[model samples]
Target: MATTTAPTTESLSDAVRRQSMAEAHTIQAMVDYRDAEMARTALIESSLRRKIERSAIALTIGEATGMSEARIQLRLSIADRVRDKTPQVWEAFVDGIIDFSRVRDISATIEKLHREESVARLENRVVGYAADHTGTELRQWLRRFVQRVEADLAVERADAARKDRHVAVAHGDDSMSWLNAYLPSHEAAAIEARLRKEARKPADPDDDRTVAQREADLLVGWCTDSDAATSAIDANIAVTVGADVLAGATPGFAESTDGCWAVPAPWLADVVATGGTFWHRIVVDPVSDDVLAHEYVGRFAPDTLAVALQFLHGVCQAPGCMVPAERCDLDHRIPHPAGPTTGDNMGPLCRRHHNLKGHGLLHWSTSPPAELIVIELYPPTPAVEMEYVAA
Candidate 1:
């Protein structure tokens, strides 16, 4: 029998690197394929329209590809936007510098500029930036950049966009469904913040529902139960707005707690003007971004330490979980009675993970004072421990 040589560490690393590059190339090829198909479809549709009277190109493409009309239209829109307005983005995509998702985001952001010149300007500024940032980061950067480019039109655009606001529900597999609301950014952020805050409250110690479940329940209850809906909107949302912007001296963006969303300054100013009574201002050090003071306006007073903990972690301490910490239960690494409820001992865990830790299905260890968390699933399956660095 011939002896087989084992792969060295260097060879293994090289193989992985090659595989990643291959995957990137494969993605780039797929994007090229999509663009070509879309171009062909567009040409055929144009010819058919001239030969006949009317042509449903998107529907025809959808039927041919087993895609819905909406999906076909969306894909065509992105392809056309990239091809016509931002060819550099398309070129970069084909070169494997960015993936399809980033390309789509670039296309969508460019289309939103309305003016071709504005779109061109933004595309010029963003194509290089997309290579280094993830899609989410790019979208956030686009928002701030748009404000810089079109400050005077922000309020008018917001008002126009608000007209398109509505709620949507979609079915999903496993008896789960998605509920989405397309609303003004400030209003939507406030609603999310309030739901998260309300989900943290439990009427009894034995309430076993997860925080996500509780939030869903709260939404349904608020819609159907008069008593639940009668309660005032009294949640403290952490918003970081520039002092000059808040004072109406300049135009900027107001960022939410988790940095996932931003609202134009003028739109936020309208919200503040009308609902000023419900707002509490938190002053932070401009250089260090540290909270210096909390000013309350309403009857509700949020725990400062709890807010600090939520801001510090931003998400659940559970491994591979992304549930916002504001919507999670503050868990003690050591059992609550034994472990003091101090910041050093407390970390946020969504209800399911909290139960897992409580029932010994999952185990987590923490380094005190600094509070570096390490989570491990039980049974030593692959023996992987995820470490969470405190922010």
Candidate 2:
């Protein structure tokens, strides 16, 4: 009988290597599939919102169609980060153009280190420890190690598609704005259904005062004090300008005293409450009944006032244009309405747009919209060009 020879050591080693490679490939494939699915689902969701009866139903469709809000968010974040990078870089990495072992080594390095500082320290430590282990010199090894770390992270990210754990609640009227997230399908459904019902409910008085009316009354009581009017004419009307200007320039001379503008009691007609802040509707002269600029007051630090302005503007101040609010600043066109150092009549304006306002080169037609203060700007050499429109 012929004796069966055992497999050679080289053959066994080759088999193990092939098995590991196959496993990694399988993981990578799964990751790719999930990523594609997430992108498709997001697109589908966007289109569906235009035709759907309610926004909640759209979310239900997403859940029923095998897409999770968490996964969608994860995919979006990953796409955003890598979107700026050259597509070729990501493509080569994803397609395994580079060695898988090198990719794995890079991933391990990146995962072990917490921050950039930590990574630098580790690189130094690794170079010293593996002084003789690697064939390449220390400097070369360090460079390779860092490259591997970044490559490894990319590979791992490709494999790690986000898991479906929640559903996102978006604005019904505006499908673009995300409102909140929901854990369970039933909860989302119930909330959406209830909102629709409430919206459809007929205007009928059941009690003495509505919730809105009661809240309005409470606000009126808080803001419009009876004794405030008498005290304002008789005693000094107190106005809190920025502490810096009050301390630095004129300590005792109040803004309400003479030449400087002071916010009158009656000018604060209707206290518009929005987003944990109060915007006072102040009329410049009560006799002429001419309304001046609407002032927004917040409890946040004065320097961080840009945040509030951005929130108000929602986008670029330029009318009918849709530039993002992120790149805008609170530019006081005609300086502070109250003549304070900060945050009186500032609106979110782009740099070029702000310069136009500051140089007095821009002409703004002030008009109050129902819910917002609309400013229409006209630049010189105008073909009726609209400059900046603030809310």
Candidate 3:
């Protein structure tokens, strides 16, 4: 009988090396091809020259590569931008520690950032981080990084984008319909968070609906019936901003603890000043990431220690987890009876991570405390207008 066996270790090693080499070569070839097409296009500078909108070069590459024109364009863009913005990321790709999939994602993120310096700083950080983390983890980190760095510009962009807020319904087969809402990130996050929270509450044992079904039902009920599922409408989320900025003494951005969105400082100040029940004050040390002070009352109050931990951590302590700290378990680092439940001894871990930690499968280090990986931001200088003197 003929039997098939796995390849030998040496053959397997050679195959892996060959695969990596091929991937690197493929990316390099694409870059060179795009450059050649661009150079060819540049030489035809007559009045009959094609407009940039005419993607003739892309079509030619698409036909050759058997990829869609749009796909080819996107791949070429990723190759070009990754090489230009962060040579380290390109090197990492060539080294085969990371692949083109990651390069495409990273390039898309960096494109959102307008400032050259911010792009360079982020590129430096993500190159090393991407080599270790999964795509989902990289995504969470990018969202937080971009939001924190472009805090001021983000506010403006959000304001502008709000004008385009909309909802649409698409009819489907079997009398079904698809509904979508294009909304501000914070508002959408809050709505979904609320639905998720409500859906998880203890329900009737006889109820056959899954969590998603429950959430959908609740959402429809709230939208169609004014009195439906109305225990509380406002979702509890965290926002951190500086008091100096709130008072208009200095400029800064208000960051959501969930890392989903950021807005101008004024929104937080308005919420707090207008007696927003859920909004509380917490003074944090930016340099050392210490929660120096806090204020709260009644329904807005949680355990003082818990609040401090949430403010300190902002997200789950598990590497790359994006679950907001407020929603996580306040786990003791050294365990309960042996470890005092102080700020230094406690941190937030999501349910899954908490289980892993409990089972001794996971470990956390406290060497570099605080979420403060200091990124120095350079503010744009004011443009000075010259006075025209009679000469």
Candidate 4:
């Protein structure tokens, strides 16, 4: 029998690097082709409408590149911005540290801010972040970053969008339909919270419906009633906003307790119009709405330590896992008797990862008190890959 060797983790990591490098070179070629097309057509197509000229070029590139013209346009847009604005990020792309998605997401968000200083700040700060995180997470952070820096814009945008809120029904394949509502963030949060709270309550002993089914039933039952507005369900809003926001300064947004959603800073008035109060909990990771993410590196700190951990490690420590820290086991990076039970040695690992650690399949290595606790697993990340907690 012939024996074959399985590829090692190091080889897989190297393969990913090679693939990203190939993609980066390909994107650069696409960008060069677009520029060449524009220059070639400039003199002859000067009399033609700009959109028409671009469409022809886009179509030609699309045929040769096997990408749709629309998609080609988007790639060109992002590439142009990256090449013009953020040299560090562009260098990362060329070196295979980040890819086209990183450039795309960062450039798209960069288009939102009007201030030169803010754009420069984002360009300087985002390369490290975009490299370390997934696209979804980068998008979320970029949005929150936008809100922090351009609070007025975010608030005004939210206000403008709220005026267009309405309910619509879409007929589905079956006999049923889908109901969708476009409400302000806070109101939507309240509705969701109340439904979840209600669903968790005791139902009939014989009822086998899940909490989700219960929520759906309750939603229908309440809306079906003549006095739907006066339904018995109640929801408590647990929100946190910056001191600057409450003072009418646009520094950051008001967010829910679990960091799920954020409303504009000025909307705090609406939240507390009748009279409500706020308190500060020292989660040891208190984030200012206005500060950059890298500034708040974790150094062992408070919230009774447990609640602090909840706020500290927002997600599972396992590589690329998305499980929320609240749903994870408070795991010691170093085994007990060797590692203390303090925050320094402990972080959040979901059950699956924690089990892997028990079997010696996973490992976590910490740097100094101020550095990230890097995880060593399949497709090993750099030991310098410490996590961050900016808020």
Index of the highest-TM-score prediction: 4
Top candidate (lDDT): 4
Q: Which pairs clash in model 3?
A: none
For every model shown, what is its TM-score relative to the native structure?
Answer: 0.53, 0.21, 0.63, 0.64
lDDT tens digits by residue: candidate 2, 1-391: 8999899987875665566456445435445555565555566656666344333433443464466655444433333332223233223334433233433343344454445764555534552343224323333444434433443443243224223445465666654554355333222332333333333335456646554554344334434774311211111122323232223432221122222232212222222111122232222332342444433432221434667667767786755646666687556544433222244355666777667666665544444343344455554333323333322
Model 3's alpha-carbon lDDT is 0.67
User: What's model 4's overall lDDT?
Assistant: 0.71
lDDT score, candidate 2, position 323: 63
Candidate 2, poorest ten consecutive residues by summed lDDT: 228-237
At residue 305, candidate 1 shows an lDDT of 61
Clashes of each: 0, 4, 0, 1
The full ranking of all candidates by lDDT, starting with the best, is 4, 3, 1, 2
RMSD (CA, Å), each prediction: 18.2, 25.8, 18.4, 19.6
| Per-residue lDDT over 1-391 for candidate 1, one digit per residue giving the tens place of the 0 to 100 score | 9999998997875664465455445444444655565565666546755444223555655676677878766766676678678888777665656666777787767766766678878878887898778778888888766765665576567668778999899999999998889998768777777788778875577888899888888888887885555375556655676565566766666666566766665555455544322445555554476776554422222477679989999999888999999999877666533444457667789999988877777666654565466666664344334332221
lDDT-better candidate, 2 vs 3: 3
* CA deviation > 4 Å runs, candidate 3: 1-21, 40-55, 232-235, 242-252, 268-283, 294-391
C-alpha lDDT of all candidate models, in order:
0.67, 0.41, 0.67, 0.71
- Per-residue C-alpha lDDT of model 4 across residues 1-391, encoded as one tens digit per residue: 9999999998887787788888888878888987886776676745657557766877877888899989888887888888887778888888988877777888887788888888888978898888888888888788878887888787777888889999999999879889999987877876787788788889889999999888887788778864323344555565666655655644457776666678775565554432212212111123544432211112222235657887888999888998998898777665543444467778888999888877777777656765767677743456544532211
Model 4 Cα shift for residue 383 (angstroms): 72
Q: Rank the candidates by TM-score, best first.
A: 4, 3, 1, 2
Pick the winner on lDDT between candidates 2 and 4: 4
